[model samples]
Target: MSGLKLEQVVKRYGATQVIHGVDLTIEDGEFCVFVGPSGCGKSTLLRMVAGLEDTSDGKISIGGRDVTRLDPAERGVAMVFQTYALYPHMTVAENMGFGLKMTGHPKAEVKAKVDEAARVLKLGDYLDRKPKALSGGQRQRVAIGRAIVRGPEVFLFDEPLSNLDAELRVEMRVEIARLHQEIGATMIYVTHDQVEAMTLADKIVVLRAGRVEQVGAPLDLYNDPDNRFVAGFIGSPAMNFFDGTLHKGGLRVPGLGDVTMAAPRNAAGAVTVGLRPNHLFLAEGDSHVVELSEQLGGVSYHYLKASDGTKLIVEAHDQSAPKPGSRTGLRIDPAKAFFFNAENGLRLR
Candidate 1:
């Protein structure tokens, strides 16, 4: 296990600075996930840590050693790419042990390490098979096993499950989590998928426009986002936001009435009211109803619009949502609402 620290890390391609100064501390044996939308520099930051991309400024330390300029191989970290970069000509065993071979380890030692990794990853059954004969999930396991045999201080995954089918991705996600627990190795994973980050990370780093927006546990980020960007980004249906003003101790929605709700700490001035889809409930005396309804078997979603045209989405277990164009009342949970500054998008009480 190893702890990783990035102090004011920056990455720039000529004058275009992609990753802004990012300072992060990943604890030993913790599974940290870097997540954001495309071009947000999540992958570039990961590559910087893996030494695939050079740091434009600041320092990167793994296990207390400054390795900001070290080569990928010299950093004592192994990276598993999204493509499952396996050598087609080599069998699973050879592929897993390739690094050991490349480093000129003894044949017997390499064989032992490969066998151990195979057993751990359940790749023993496919030792002699090439990448073509393996399923997507199995191929990914081979990729992970390849990293496992390296015995690196840290494991870096770059959207390692992106190529798999939905079901396969879920399975691999669980497998990766289990592997992290069993090995207790420090892992840094980069993905655009919030579900993956929510499930696998001990800490999630939410990024936007080359800057770190927030870093917290999954539920911490979900329940207490630092800004409007984070509040909207962390949730599934996403937190709903519309133009609203703060009035004394309450909030006023443009198309809706003055909502008597507590604001998040430090909230004042012109602020946007933030509420999650799940936080809004169908109420008896409300004035929003179904503009559209989508029923996905066990769960139903109602896309609603207030009398003045404010859109709201509600996810409910109620399988019988009103049909499109039907009017319904909705209630907001006062305590669950968040308020953000209109100017900078930061949370305010």
Candidate 2:
């Protein structure tokens, strides 16, 4: 296991820059996840670390070794991509030991390593089965086992679960998390799913448009985001935003029945008020109309539209669900509200 560091890491294609200067550090044995929307350069940046994409500028180091210009094989990193990319003709054991065999490792040595990897991944029973005979999740485990046999310093996973079905995705997530804990390897995972990021990462690096938006533990980012984008992107169902005017006295938001509340210190003028779905509750009165309601057993989601046409979603824990087109009111928790500058989207301290 080893730590990885990126100093002003950058990537470009001709004159078009896809990744800007990004500085980050992943401590040894940390499960770090790079999360962002599509086209945000998360994959591009991961490719750079793998030495598969040229770093237009900047430095990348793994285990205290400068590998900025090193070849992919020399970078001491094993990558598990979105595709399984396993050999259909080879048995699971052969597929997992292929890398070592190609490098002239003795047959016995390769078998031992493959055996250990299979044990760790719970694929011992499937060793003799070919890729065609394995399920999607098992095939992916074979792919991961292949990487493990190489014993690289770092593991890079680029949306490794995207191809799996919903149930398989969840199953694979637990498998990967367990693998990380058992091996204690330094792993960098890239994904657009915030739920995955929140559940899997020890630390998450949130990116946007090739720049670092924020980096912190999942719950830290969710509870205290530095800007509007991070706040919206880090949480599931996303945070709800309301346009409000901040004055010396308080803040007024028409979307919440023209509600007024105390403003943060030194905040004034046009600001965006953010509230999580769970923070907002349904109440009596007809300030808004329920556009839709989703009941998922233990919890329900109410989609509402204010009289002024502002849309919002409220999460409720009860079984009661309002009917569509029904009049309703929203209750906001002032203490849980977040304020950001409307123009710049920066948090108001």
Among these predicted structures, which one has the highest TM-score?
Answer: 2
lDDT of 2 by residue, 160-275 (tens): 99999999999999999999999999999999999999999999999999999999999999999999999999897999999998765689899988899888785767989999
- Against the reference, the lDDT scores of all candidates come to 0.89, 0.94
Model 2: which ten-residue window has the lowest total lDDT? Answer: 261-270
Query: Candidate 1, residues 1-349: lDDT per residue as tens digits?
Result: 6899999999999999999899999999999999999989999999999999999999999999999989999999999999998999999999999999999999999999999999888889999999999999999999999999999999999999999999999999999999998899999999999999999999999999999999999999999899898998897988888677667756677544345555455666777888788887776655775788889988877888887778878888877777687777777777777878899988875
Q: Each candidate: RMSD to true structure? A: 1.8, 0.8
lDDT (Cα, 0-100) at 300 in candidate 1: 78
lDDT of 1: 0.89
In order of appearance, the predictions have TM-scores of: 0.95, 0.99
Quote the positional error of residue 207 for candidate 1 in Å: 0.9
Reference-based TM-score, model 2: 0.99
